[model samples]
Target: MSAEFLAELATLTDPAGILTGAATDGYLLDQRRRFAGRALAVARPRDTAEVAAMLALCHRHRVAVVPQGGNTSLCGGATPDSSGQALLLSLERFHGIDDIDADNNTITVAAGATLASVQAAARSAGRLFPADWAAAASCQIGGALATNAGGINVLRYGNMRNLVLGLEVVLADGTIWNGLRGLRKDNTGYDLKQLFVGSEGTLGIITRAVLRLYPAPTAHATALVPVAGPQAALELLHELQAAAGDRITSFELISAPCMALLAQHFPALPQPFAPIPDWLVLIELADAGEDSALQDKLAEVLFAQGLDEALLAQHASQSRAFWELRESIPEAQRLEGVSIKHDISVPLSAIPDFIEQCGRALLAAYPTAQIIAFGHLGDGNLHYNIFLPDHSAGVYAEEEHINAIIYREVAERRGSFSAEHGIGQLKRGLMQHYRSPVELALMRQIKQALDPHNLMNPGKFLPD
Candidate 1:
């Protein structure tokens, strides 16, 4: 089987033995290292024609394919399972960019281009890509589109779904679907370009994409505001929305305990904010109009919030210093010890109650368990991770029960178990347990329709 498949691929692609061995050191494992899996080989295809040939070979040989880029998935989405039946298809070398239309504000790029690379290309062309993620340096555009990633700038520019205009996907049968049109308005039959976005690479392989661009912001005003709690933060979000509207680009919520943990782990950076406060909000304002007064509007809204105390950074450097406090929380927590993470989301109004009740429940179960909750509150998403103080014994062993405790509560509140992160193998069973039968059945139908042989991605999003 190996000889037949390698010879077939070699006839159609350069470096046919590229699927052999030792090329997947960093690309095979995940960030958590919780889900390690085996694969037949790692296939690196530099162009769409090569991708089609590889897929055709895998399809004929009855081998499962796992499409991977940057290998930075937080929820084990990109990594395959221990079953050696799967093949890892890495698209990292398909990095090409073109400024198709400067006046029309559109750019086409190969799917493997890193987010930072695309953003830099846009900036060099005097435009902005607008979609920003914390892992921009490592995460590629293909992975971002597959997962429909949301990040800090989502408040104004929207998620990956909103930024994409067209896609080029290779079908399950090795047929290339070249739907890469840059038209702003086209009422064509299917609008099939959207079918691949957010599909988690199940429908097909996204080889390239056409993206919309915006004029670069001429001015940037940032602030780090302190609030009493989620309620105050929500109230402030409304106030800023009414005042600055689209100019208020990003509004983030950070908890006092989260800040304290960073100080505990990374002592090099002094903790600027007091820890007694309950919640904090990081506000960033930007405008394309060079004369826009975003700073004055932000200050006015924060001062009007009589219930909360806010500290706006006087300069861009100071604002970034404050933002670093929030960014470092995840890394510091990782440095501290093992943690059971839940990338969950509730309604914008239900955030405070969710946090309060979940913390109380954890305390009731195990008082020493630390509940580290922080994320993009403006968009109604929070990273509610559980950290145990007694890391000496059976810490990871407690993951199953801890998940049940939190997930049950999440189901009770009608919240999403996996919000921004796609469900790889980690939440497979929970999805079946919580999702309505009708919803699960529809997903299965879609899966069967697109990939009848179950070759696209065998066991990731949908539950068996």
Candidate 2:
């Protein structure tokens, strides 16, 4: 970024000292503080029009602009490199509930609306906005859409890509793409809105969206079932899916190590099982119907099939307690310190085998490594992470060797190296190793076509 361009942007955004010391703040650092870079400046746009103007100016001057929604991206998507050429564009100020299309079963929201707020607004209107994330409280809608995020409810409602019906986006050259029609069915030339959904700010910045809604489910049935291993898990998943089918809102796989870690760190959480089983599958069933007998019947089936050796959490209060343990796995691991993480997905049929084989392979390679596995199993996604056996090795390592060990196995299984958490700066190398030559070249072509100057979040999610 040149001095002349910096002066123009500072004037346009009207930020507090953006031309000087603002870049020294935490805004430029990635989550986990693993990647930090010098941004030319951090520009906060108050609304869509200003965002458009900012992008337009950057385009004219050939300055690189990195579109950031909440600065809460887990994979370093929001951070710039050391070049200081990229301007971090934050849309957090453009927040407000635009309109509630209650009759249309849609909600129009600004890109900066937090996911938690959007969900709350839908709840107020007696509708369901099922998209959620652990970072829902902080992550903005545009970031969620940019990554096409999938969370706990993906088993029933699908990912963010399925939840969004329409979007209002600004193109690479600052041209508006107003395709925000809240219709369920519209047969047009191209479903152009989708092109920007998971483009990760490489293609364009999503400024607004029309989100799909469903009837709010008032009753829930949640449980934690202790099962043996992969085969048992497959059997249990089939049995539960057969019983509740779509009502099986979430079927998450939890490893014994996960529980042990929780017990070790989160001591307040009481153990639900006598002896920790090899794995546990936390299940939740919710319906828009009034009947609350789902939990009773679910507990009965687990007992009868011997699918679950032990059952935890029957009532809503108990259900919440059970969920707290599952949700705390990440936090507990964080408390333990940094670890190697792989957000991977294999076929649903291959989940148990994948887990068992992956575990065995890693144990064979790095015997002292502690494996932590848990995730949304219904969709075949797993948060398969590894912790160093000793405290000294937690954050730093000759980790490239271990990364190779895991990613190579994932590729062998024909699985996605990145299931939900995207290919932010950390996984760019892995993408090259996993993605084919033609596919990568095509992505480069798309980036070149849309962002010709390489000035829109370049050097991210793509090989440099």
Per-residue lDDT of 1-464 in model 1, one digit per residue for the tens?
86777666667656743665666566678887877887887888889998998898888898789999888788888998887778888898888895557788888999899999999999999999998867989899999999888888888888888888888999888899888888889997887877777777887899999998998998877777778788878888888888888887788888887888887888887576665466778888889654336677777777777634566667778878877887888898888778888988778888888888888888899889988889988788888888888653357788888888888778778888877777877877787788999999988887888789999977787878
Give per-model CA RMSD. Answer: 2.0, 1.8
Model 2 agreement with the true structure over 1-464: per-residue lDDT tens digits: 37898878777755653544654477888877788888777788887777888888889988788888777777898888888877788888888999888888899999999999999999999999998767889999999999889999999999999999999998778888898899888997889888787788988889999999888887787777877776687788788888878888888889888999899999999788867877888888888664357767677768877754556455678887888888899999888877888899988887877777777888898888888889998898999888876644443664787777777777787999888888888888777778999998998898888888887788788877
lDDT of 2: 0.83
Clashes of each: 0, 0
Candidate 1 residue 45 C-alpha distance from true site, Å: 0.8
Please report how far candidate 2 places residue 343 from its true position, in Å. 0.3
TM-score of 2: 0.95
Ten residues in sequence with the least summed lDDT for candidate 2: 15-24
| Top TM-score prediction, candidate number | 2
